[model samples]
Target chain A: MSELFDPLLAPYDERRRAELVAAYMAVEHAAAPVPEVRFPALREPALRRTVAAMLALSGRTLVRGADRDWTSGYHDDVAAALAADPACVLPVEDRAVLTLVLVHSVAIPRATGTLGEDTWLSPYPAAADELRRRSQLPVGELEAALRRLRTAGLVTQVKAGGDEAGGYVPGPQFHRLTPGARRRLQEELILAAGPDSPLAAAIRARRRSNEEAS
Target chain B: MSDEWAPGILARARARVTGAVSVPAAEPVPPGLAAVPDGPRTWLLPSWPDGATPAVLEQYELAPMPLDRSGQARRVLAAALRCCWANLDDAPWPGVPAPVPAVLDVYAGMTRGDAALAGRWATGELRRLADTGWLVLDEARGVVRTGPRTALWPHEALGPLRDLLRRMPGPSREALGDE
Candidate 1:
């Protein structure tokens, strides 16, 4: 919101460019049950392991793959990283934010594959929330952010559990996250799992345990 | 431009109405681009060529765009432009032969679709073509302009676009049905 913050972001913005940075992060990274991934369970190391296992598999794809599937790679990368609780501790860095936006936000890649244009997913509420939290900023501007993402086909009003019946999940509406939206989600994941990433080795160990158990 | 979804999204909507005319011999778009029954009639599509500037995508009724980062915006705009051009151009003109400027301008006003972020810079580069002519728009029929142009067609140019849909990339190319 403040012009001051905009200039400060320049350096961070420059560093986090490209759609397929974490090329190794893949959707098949964690073979654990998708439905089993719950927020409260995220606190448990065992469950976190399951998530981490999945995350490690994904990290490879993000860091290694030449061509990435926006839907599969993005969802896998973000889901695994979020489960590791990147937001809870380090709170998702700007680099990770860019990763999330790159893969998850179709608006950006959709722009790239066609027009040599790429509109990142920084405007996303989840993305913005994560950014504001890391920057230690407040969440005063809701209407403006929501309006832009919605129009850009990035963000949507997420109706959680109580908002629906027993069949519904307690998360944002699927919102038809496109290939472009994947870019946004991926950027966030990358930031959450940087070079000194705590989630990396942690996820590997979890996977090792799961493999041994199985 | 308005942020409300534009008309002519489907075959019927794009048909010959009292005022607007549809291209003749146009085929029904495959399900991926024109699954009329499944997808919403309204969509916030990104305008092409010039990137999806808030102003451009807004023109076609898409709104609530995130406002940050020129780099990201430019990339997304490029992708959206490709999607639109790929589908709308029934002929699929690839890389227009004329100079980038005049071709882009005519493409913009003609396609009535503005994803041409490149047009802002390349407008002056296009040369007037021998057969291409610019038709002034009256109230009913939007004007038609021909001659040297900018922008890529993805396919061969069928001369000056005879109809609104004619000037556009085929609907199947938009990847709408893929959704």
Candidate 2:
């Protein structure tokens, strides 16, 4: 088979290729899911080849996540470059959801007395409840808002043990943040929740141990 | 410079960075900071006394990585990475650690024995990758995410493999254990 041949995408005109690649490059706000194509059309080898060539030439990578659907991300180099100057351009709802996911990943465990990081997984119903409690948005809008977050790669849905519908957690893009950034965000959470916060207590405990050891 | 406790201190520091664990201070001084003759009582990371080389921090950047070609493990991990790649147009979330069991669950269709082996292989691979700065595993969080140094891996190297996977028939592709 030709090196350029991929069996999963349609033949790419230069305009179409540019549009797709440019779309990915412009996503400085958040990660976005790949646009879905009908299986039959995408199954054509010639089309897939054209698509793969476009992606490779443009330095894009095709990936999948908890949603079990294909998505795309810029190559690591491109992503790092874009991250240097990210803009908060996501829609307000998306921004809100992303913020909640970020805060939830770090704060939820402390709030619920779940010490483990895995408890960061917030179920859909729980998220809806939280949103309702905080923003007072109708419960009906919660699913759509969560879906928007998922599409933006800020939230991931994962199986909740034996639960059929699953739950939400910080998605792949959340992990892309620098450690300094994660630390800063956690610090903010602690401040808002007060020094008596569980996370604060955890930090204090570590510091105390260090002092005693010294 | 020749402190016997340097290794232990360094290990603790790395854990603190990668796993978010709170590490206790080393005797007389904490790791990652320069030794001060009359330093203040409070310990702070990223502070260095004048003329100190910050050896522990420097060593982290230059640590030697052991390359192990455990094919099954690589295949399993690569598959997981590919999934995340397909799902987002950015790097997988560094802050949120993915659950290992959930990752394995996606490939549960494999033969039970192969699936079991894949789990073991994945554990070994994750540890190796974590050591090499390709991945971070938060034991307390029970989650895994890409490491800070993930950009160091060759970006275009997986293109051909991804292309081949893309061309596989749907059912056959499904049989590969991708959800």
Candidate 3:
């Protein structure tokens, strides 16, 4: 179904929906090391609209952070629509597992020098193990969430492991993110992870090398 | 307006654009030989030039829409509509009914602060796009879907966009698995 139609969230009462939207936004705009929401703000129409727009455009949501007390990360669609349209919004729930997935999809590529031309993909069990390390959610719950992300088109299964097991790569939506949105995300990473961070350096060196190669 | 009524209101507005004519699916192409060669001689068919397909041409025609008041509003609506279309899995494909409230959420999100005003803008834009026959709105069902025009968005037309997106850097680089 369209990301527009979220059955999991459709049945909630209006107030609860409002609260979830509010909570999602708090972490989305939070500037702390880890973003969290204390009281869901009921008065921010712009924030609400932003979330709706992001969800509408991308079918992804912001969830509470797991690695940190309160943090935010793009769950599905890998920030494609939000990156394209900076005016977008996001979701909250299954915070840690989803964050781990997002980090795995978005971050780890450069860290491992596996980005560009050939994307480094991971098997489901490997992702599950990493997610288990970061969050308190059980294996089943993490798998369920991963399934949900796949259903949402945020991540796609790839043919790997020679039929023994399949791996995953970023979904089609990941490639749809706008350059501006991608740049903004990179800036955020540079600030949080620092310009001298190994991943950042890898990314820079990759770009420099690619430019020189071309 | 209270948050309670926002969704309902958006749905009702979308219902206003309901009803559209569906076009027939495109025709299939005939199969042909890849290439042929005989005794150091070769015969080759000229390659079809890029942008020669109907879809590409149609997309090119629709590409330069000005992003003014209604223009910008219409684009936002289009994005939401695309999502509505994208989410149609197991619902008999692209003709799935879309919730107006969901489509409006996209516009409302972008406009922020004044959802009422944004709703008005969206309603007006929807009507306009509907009038152009590019979008079909089912007001009674409170859903919307792409009109016949969108069928023209050929795979080739999106090539450049896909390339650009592929080249863009991701947000982070934290390793998650041993692989």
TM agreement with the true structure for every prediction: 0.23, 0.28, 0.28
Q: Chain A TM-score for each candidate, in the given order?
A: 0.23, 0.41, 0.39
For model 1, the stretches where C-alpha displacement exceeds 4 angstroms are A1-95, A98-124, A127-204, A211-214, B1-96, B107-161, B165-179
Question: What is the per-residue lDDT of model 2 for residues A1-214, given as tens digits with 9 covering 90 to 100?
Answer: 1122223223556555433333322221123332233222123445444443444333344443234323344445443333443331455666566556556555766567664442323433235445557645566676667765664456776655664544567765653343344454566566555787787888778768988998
Q: For candidate 1, lDDT tens digit of each residue in B86-143?
A: 3444433222222222234334433333445545422311211211111111213221
- List candidate 2 segments past 4 Å from native: A1-87, A102-105, A111-113, A116-127, A139-141, A159-165, A191-214, B1-179
How good is the docking of model 2, as DockQ?
Answer: 0.01
Weakest 10 consecutive residues, lDDT, candidate 2 chain B? B45-54
Candidate 3 lDDT score at position A55: 38
List chain B TM-scores, each candidate: 0.17, 0.44, 0.47
The residue-by-residue lDDT of candidate 2 on B1-179, one tens digit each, is: 12132343343233323322222344444343322221222222222111122132222232211123445555545544543344343434332445655545443433256767766766666665665444566667666665544332334544664564454322234333356
Looking at model 1 chain B, report the run of 10 residues with the lowest lDDT sum.
B127-136
Lowest lDDT 10-residue stretch of candidate 1 chain A: A17-26
Q: Which stretches of candidate 3 lie over 4 Å from their true place?
A: A1-90, A94-98, A117-126, A158-160, A163-167, A189-214, B1-179
